[model samples]
Target: MIADAAKKLRENIQKVIVGKDEVINLTLVAVLCEGHLLLEDVPGIGKTTLARALAASLGATYRRIQFTPDLLPSDVTGLNWFNQKKQEFVYRPGPVMS
Candidate 1:
């Protein structure tokens, strides 16, 4: 059953992505294991497209965060801010929260 779902997702992603079964397989594995995927490669290699495709295949929301050397942890995970109206701190979810 899980394999069938993965196969469906792979096919959906393949519609937009070219020949990269290994990448798709790794993505499936990561999803199954509830892990993260880090695609470090040259630009214009379908990294962002693949991620967006998978998100769309799963009917999930998509958000992009440009990681940089100077990026803080709060930037990716968000931070609490004081809401003046409520007079309390509230968490603003970051891209990872998507």
Candidate 2:
């Protein structure tokens, strides 16, 4: 049953991503095991796309943070916005919070 669900998920992802079944299956294994994956691949090799595709397949919210020299911690955590009318700070959730 888990295998079937994974296969269906893969099929759903394949609609958007192409030519990477083996890698997709390997990534799906981690997902099935409820473990996070560390994909150490070069740029433009579909790593991000694969992650996004899988997230879409499972109806999960997807977010990508690009690590760069100038990246800041708050970028990932988001900032609190002040609502003048309410006179209180409202917390705007980030992608991670989503």
lDDT winner among the candidates? 1
Residue pairs with backbone overlap in model 2: none
Q: What is the per-residue lDDT of model 2 for residues 15-57, given as tens digits with 9 covering 90 to 100?
A: 8779988888888888889898898888888888888888878
**Largest TM-score belongs to which candidate?**
1
After superposing candidate 1 on the true structure, give the runs of residues whose Cα lies further than 4 Å from its correct spot: none
Question: In model 1, where is the ten-residue run with the lowest total lDDT?
Answer: 36-45
Candidate 2 CA-lDDT value: 0.83
In angstroms, the error of model 2 at 43 is 1.8
lDDT for model 1: 0.92
Q: What is the C-alpha lDDT of each candidate?
A: 0.92, 0.83
Clashes of 2: 0
Q: Pick out the ten consecutive residues of candidate 2 with the lowest summed lDDT.
A: 89-98
